[model samples]
Target: MDFKEKFSTIKKHLLTGTSHMIPFIVAGGILFSLAVMLNPEGAATPETGWLGDLASIGSAGLTLFVPVLGGYIAYSIADKPGLAPGMIGAYLASQVGAGFLGGIVAGFIAGYVVKALKKIKLPISLKSLGSIFLYPLFGTLITGGIIVWVIGTPISAIMEGLTGWLNSLSDAGKVPLASILGAMTAFDMGGPINKVATLFAQTQVDTLPYLMGGSRSSYLYTTNWNGNCNIVSSKKI
Candidate 1:
């Protein structure tokens, strides 16, 4: 296809692709967030209560099975042609903790890569080469490599580093930190403040798991107390 034609096709794909995935993204994110809220190690852990079960279910939807969402999105953009490999690509991305971002990236990569692969001109009969070894071979290698080496590793590092820093703060610092997070969350109605607190909590989860017996509960309690303080600050306003 000519440049104009390719641009038009790509534009059409982008619109269709984004439209297909947006709902899943929103739903999955909401479900994941709700799961986190319900699972808070507060009055009851997610292991027992009704809310805990509900949270588990929601979290399960986005867990290792997230490829289904990416697959469907690709199917919407590239039709039936994109479904199989799109799922494959998404599964690989999720393995490295890319979560939703990985899923979306995989969907776009699989759809467009397959679309472009189909358009490649060759002297040999594409019918034989195309199905036999083209799409799966090239698509999987490219998408998998990009995610494993380029995208996934660096993002995972940042996530790890952020969590590490939060865990390193002294005990006295936690409540203040949590308070700041709570204030931020409540102030923005759960946008920025929620992010800060959630980041700290996630960090705690990673690091506090190593604490023996009593230290675990104590550390968790302080963080929650601080978070409540921040929320109270917002309420006071």
Candidate 2:
């Protein structure tokens, strides 16, 4: 395939994963927002009350965010065979503090690994075993191993470094940074460009709230503008 075709294919796969992940993010975000709204004092311990319960549920959903994303991405690439290993690898990525970017990497790894596994020939009787046992077993082992031992530490360090750099930015620098992110996010609605900005913000939410805030504002602004344009065009008819 040519470069554009290859990029389109990759974008499609990424969007497939992202589309599946949106519901989880929305649900978790609502619950999290409600939890904080209901317990703004930050005293909502796990055993406290419904507020704490809401927080826990929200936290749980968010925790699954990365694994689901990775699994679905793999599914987009290699169908059902890729799902289990992708999720496992993604979980390892999260455990190692690799975040959303790592989850994306894990998804690609698991998908390709399963695809490669499918190419191996086996005896008639062994074929059944290969599908049911061997593929998942080895796929998980290899993908998880690479994610945890080889790539995880370096990715974690990079994420940390990015977080620190963002945190240390001066007020003047922050305005420009936010402006750039906002423009990127608002450029294409929910297209690949928008997703890139969103994924970055999601990964850094705990460490860099400002980026998320800026992106959200920009998204809202662009969405409103589109809605107004639609309304105006309708009135002209």
Candidate 3:
């Protein structure tokens, strides 16, 4: 394929991960919201009650989303062998405060690294070991090394800056920002722009619900609308 085609494939890989991530976002977000709703004072998350338990479960889901996104994106590129390395890298990304953008970077790196590794010629006996042993081991090491040593610090700094900026925006500033995200959603449907917007919003979901609140409403509307379009297209009507 041409470079354009190759580049465009990244969108498919991204969407693959994003699609897998939605259920986690939706389910966890609802549970967490419920827990917050039950507390009258909104002082802090209940630590002992069922609400606490629910919040914990939701928090787990939110925590894993970065890994899931990385895992599935690599899986799209390099199949089963890439899954472990991608998740490992993404988990490292989160630990370093790299956010979803870092997760995406981790996924792509793991995928391509694994893909390149698969090209190494091996003896018949050793070839059999590539899938179960060599791939995961080397893949994790190289990918994780890049994350922990190379990109981790810079990416973390960027995420911190982004978080600070998002927090600093006044409520009025949010409307234009939310409107732009909506416009991107409508303009691209489920394309790369939409994916980027969704990832940006998702990164803030746990710490800042109101930001995601705006994205979520538009997301639901677009989802239903897209479903209807799919049905119509299927019917050729």
Candidate 4:
């Protein structure tokens, strides 16, 4: 395929993965937000009963986000055969602190590896085993190994460096960064650019709460602005 075709194919795969992952993100994000809103005063501990339970469930769902994304991405690429390995690799990526970017890498790796495995010729007797046993087993091992040993370290390092850099930035420096992120979020609403910016903010929430807060506030502002404008326009007509 030519450059454009290759780019399009890659975009398609990524979008497929992202599309499948959205429901999980939406559900988890809503639950998480609700939990936080319910406990805004920070007075409720995990022992606080129903509120705590809801918070825990939300947290668990959020944790599964990366694995689901990776698994679906692989499934998009290589069907059911890629599902197990992709989830395993993505889980490892999360454990190793590589975050969503690493999950994306792991998904692609699992998909391609499984696709390659399918090309191997085995005896008729062994062929049945390939799909049921061998593919998931070996594919997971290889994918998890690569993610943990090869990809994980560099990604963690980069995340740390980025976090540190962002933290070190002066208020003036942060303005430009925040502006770009806000603009990206506002540019397309729920489109790819908006999703990308939102994901970046979500991933950084733990280490850089302010950045995520800024991005989210900007998003809310833009959304409200658009809604109000629509209402006014409708009234004029």
C-alpha RMSD of each candidate structure in angstroms: 11.2, 5.2, 5.6, 5.9
lDDT of 4 by residue, 1-237 (tens): 899888677667777777776677667656666666678566333436677777777667678878988897888888888999999998999899888888888999999999899899989999989987888888899999999889898987776776666676635577767766766666665556776776777655434545655455333333364456321121110
Positional deviation of 112 in candidate 3, in angstroms? 0.5
| Model 2, global lDDT | 0.78
Superposed model 3: Cα runs more than 4 Å off:
171-173, 216-237
Best candidate (score: lDDT): 3
Error of model 2, residue 205, in angstroms: 4.3
Candidate 1 residue pairs that clash: 184-193, 185-193, 185-194
**lDDT of each residue in 1-237, candidate 1, tens digit only:** 999887666455444544454454345445655655666575333666676676565555445344765576566555665776677777777788665456667777877777777777755766676654676567667767777778876655665675557466535565655554444444443333443343334323313422212121212112364455222231321
Model 1 bad stretches (over 4 Å): 1-45, 49-52, 64-69, 120-134, 157-237
lDDT tens digits, residue span 90-137, model 3:
999999989887898999999999999999998999998898889989
Cα TM-score of candidate 4:
0.78
Residues 58-150, candidate 2, lDDT per residue (tens digit)?
777788889998998888887887899999998999999888888999999998999899899988988888766888789889999999889
Clashes of 1: 3
- The residue pairs that clash in candidate 3, if any, are none
Worst 10 residues of 2 by lDDT: 228-237
Which lDDT values do the candidates have, in the order given? 0.55, 0.78, 0.80, 0.74
TM-score result, candidate 3: 0.86
The better candidate by TM-score, 2 or 4, is 2
Q: Which ranking of candidates, highest TM-score first?
A: 3, 2, 4, 1
The predicted structure with the larger lDDT, 3 or 4, is 3
